[model samples]
Target: MSKQHVHGSHPDIVKRLKRAEGHLQRVIAMFAEGRPCLDLAQQLHAVEKAISEAKKTLIHDHVDNCLDDAATGGPGKSARNVLAEFKAISRYL
Candidate 1:
């Protein structure tokens, strides 16, 4: 069956990811320039945080939309589908 396309958070996630990508480029440039270790570590921390937040946002969107689909009005909301989703998201824990 064809998958449903609910791109509610796609644009927002893309913006966040792009922001993180810019930060990562700056970090790489800073590293090459022999920036101070403390400053570099701080920049690295920011990059990590941005990426982590993006990951969390994507996971939240997936869980919200996909679980709602399995439990409500979209399609194929059988117990099996819900169980499958639960098992799939367990890897994130």
Candidate 2:
């Protein structure tokens, strides 16, 4: 199947990536300083949650804009494709 296009690469996505980078740097520092396992785990969990939230935001935007546009003049194929992609991504989350 052809790759589905999504409307991302927006300013918000870029900002989220920058924040995630900062979070990762802190995680590295925590490892270097021999931080407590529980503390490190908590921070990692927060990072994961942030990333997940960002992803959902991007996906929702794409569904609302890009996918909605693509769904026109089809047998609802574009919508089906978008739903399939979401399902696949949900497995990772």
Candidate 3:
């Protein structure tokens, strides 16, 4: 279905992902520049953490808004479908 508007925390999540993307790009450049292994590892870790936190925020927002809507009869999917969707999304977390 078409989205009606920006969901909760999505704008923040997008900003986080963009930051992570920038970090990842820097990490790639570091590799090419023969940066020290310790520096590379630290940068890579930051990138990984950023992506992980973004994923967590997205999933939590989905559960808080979408699943809550479905449970409250807010023009969402059926109960079975909602549960399935929740399960599907939870795998990423």
Candidate 4:
């Protein structure tokens, strides 16, 4: 099957991931600069949460679009495949 979907969340998710990337880079730099543990932990936590949120958004978009389409008899998909894909993605939750 084609690997593209019509979801509108892709750009938002990319922006979120980029923000998380920036946070991660700053955290790495802070670690190298000998920043305090608490400050570093907070920034790292922000990065983690940003990434987690982005992942959730992407997974939700996929489920709403892809799985729903497949379940509704979209071309080139089967119930077993949709179930497998849903099972695979649920691990991230």
Candidate 5:
């Protein structure tokens, strides 16, 4: 399968990624400080959840703008292609 073409840069998406990055830095600092394993695990889980939510937001936006346009008879072939891509993405989640 091919990669889905994301439309434009989303500020919210960037913010989410930055938050995830901060979480990662925290995880590293915790490790360096020899923090409790449970605390580290919880932070890791939070990072994972944040990343997952960010991905969902992107997918939702793509569907709303690109996929919806295609489905509405904008271009038959392109619509089918985009629909397939969306389905593949759903599988990943």
Candidate 6:
């Protein structure tokens, strides 16, 4: 299903994030409706996992594209460019 829609980072990543968003919204609504803690926790866990997977996918794409390009380039990449990009990625940690 996700293989059909590639946007932003990747199709799968976007799909996971969209699912997580839906779960998160549902969780919020459940909270408003005084839903059970146990059920909320389970849904929240799914949302968390989805968001985590999306983050991992986004990072993977960054590394695969930007870092890979920086690593293997004839003259397009510079030390400053790679260093800046690495620093940007470091902020995620």
TM-score: which candidate is best? Answer: 4
lDDT of 3 by residue, 13-36 (tens): 999999999889989999999999
From the highest lDDT down, the ranking of the candidates is: 4, 3, 5, 1, 6, 2
lDDT by candidate, in order shown: 0.83, 0.76, 0.91, 0.92, 0.85, 0.80
- lDDT value, residue 46 of candidate 3: 92
TM-score of each: 0.82, 0.69, 0.87, 0.88, 0.81, 0.73
| RMSD score of candidate 3 (Å) | 1.7
Residue lDDT tens for model 4, 21-59: 988998999999999999988998899999999999999
Number of backbone clashes in candidate 4: 0
Per-residue alpha-carbon lDDT of model 6 for 1-93, expressed as tens digits? 455523357877767888889889999999999999999999999898888878877877887777777778736778788878878886774
Model 6 residue runs over 4 Å out of place are 1-9
Error of 4 at 81 (Å): 1.3
Tens-digit per-residue lDDT, 1-93, candidate 2: 998653555678778878988998999899999999999999999888878878877767766665566566444466678678657755654
Better of 1 and 3 by TM-score: 3
Q: Can you tell me which runs of candidate 1 are displaced by over 4 Å?
A: 1-6
7, model 2: CA deviation in Å?
4.6
In model 5, the clashing pairs are none
Candidate RMSDs in order: 2.3, 3.9, 1.7, 1.9, 3.4, 5.7
Q: Which stretches of candidate 4 lie above 4 Å from their native place?
A: 1-6
Root-mean-square deviation of Cα positions for candidate 1 versus the true structure, in angstroms = 2.3
Candidate 5 lDDT for residue 81: 92
